[model samples]
Target: MNLATNVRIVLVEPAGALNVGAIARVMKNMGLYQLVLVNPQCDPLGEEARRMAVHGGEVLEGATRFENLPEALEGCQRAIATTARDRHVPLTLETPKQVLPWCLEGSPTALIFGPEYRGLSNQELNYAQRFLGIPSNPEYPSLNLAQAVAVCVYELYQLSQNNLAVPPQTTEAARLEDIEGYYQHLESTLLKIGYLQPHTATARMAKFRRLYNRASLSHDEVALLRGILRQVEWAIKPQAGDAE
Candidate 1:
């Protein structure tokens, strides 16, 4: 299988048909095909989008749609979300060149972009394992949605052509969906144990996410961790024989 096909370009709540069409055209130009739209604000197949797509119409037509970011990234092992916002907790923001290569290492990966106007919120950003911030002039740092797609697509295309030095995969990384399940299991357990208060759970979970993302846990690795959590829950539960 062409590893290039493993990379998905996911647009979250994109607003402009023209921009979506243009993004399709650029993906075709760079030999990338997977385009995923999450709750798009405009019809990707509308006239405006079609008009901009020109010869790249097929890419636009073949685009898949999802209700949310997590669904769009269901099978992905790694994901990077694009954002210009600064977080209070401070996630390390790397340029596209620095982080984009991580996706090309053979497992399914996603490059996420937020809406045109407001960008991604912290909650939405939580779904990604990494964050991308394209370098631009401080005077006007924002890039048009299509322009941003083009820049990232070009970088990926160049790396793919150069045969980026990716080590052969020996173990499968935990799919984002599985990792998310573990996170949920972990959070619930933590709450039951009084380790996490309701108001503080979200913030504390973000730190856990960062820690796990950095570890790049494999499928079995995550399973083992979750197994431990389940055992902990079992051990802590009140025995029926002991209840007064």
Candidate 2:
């Protein structure tokens, strides 16, 4: 039903040309097109990549490159990133079947995969509102980059092509930048009010990010929160002299 057009697959710091090429091929097979590479270590158009891409050469050649994850995700309203390992902090890692449908609910959505050696770092993972991990044999749990792409794309393509009931987006989801702005404003306002100490702010803010992400706040909700932060700043500025 032409649903795959809005989906984007992002590869972070991919270093293997073959993996890049194969990923392109699989994406095309699954009727998915958009591909973004963040600080890739290999040329996606190289011979090895092209050889692997074969029929999907167009996808590989058309892939966009970015210096960082946030840059790669600029316009995405919904995103799910993959991580192989567990985190020290609390996070729900869903199976592909469980999270793939979320990709269809928003315009310009994203599914991110980390490099071959290591999956996404905690900082990089924070950018994504959701996280996924494919269930595999625990004794040899890791999957190669191309394989991971293939698996997720296949499942997503099926969900997209079939008229499966993905819950209609009731409210326009806030863009990534909008959510990020709220986080920044929230942090600064909290610090100004002595509610967030500098030493513990990063960790505390992460928990907040996770909380709000799960809420999947709409654009208006984000605006309302930001307005609260602004008013708080205005109310507290007069008491600035008391802090010292």
TM-score of each: 0.97, 0.94
Q: What lDDT does the true structure give each of the candidates?
A: 0.91, 0.88
Give the best candidate by TM-score: 1
Name the lDDT value of residue 183 in candidate 2: 93
- Best-fitting candidate, measured by lDDT? 1
Clashes of each: 0, 0
Question: Candidate 1, residues 80-178: lDDT per residue as tens digits?
Answer: 989887767578899988998887788899999999999888998888888899999999999999999999999888888888837747898999999
Local accuracy of candidate 2 as per-residue lDDT tens digits, 57-145 = 99987899999988898898988989879779688989989998877764678899998988888888889899999999999998998
lDDT against true structure, model 2: 0.88
Task: Supply the global lDDT for candidate 1.
Answer: 0.91
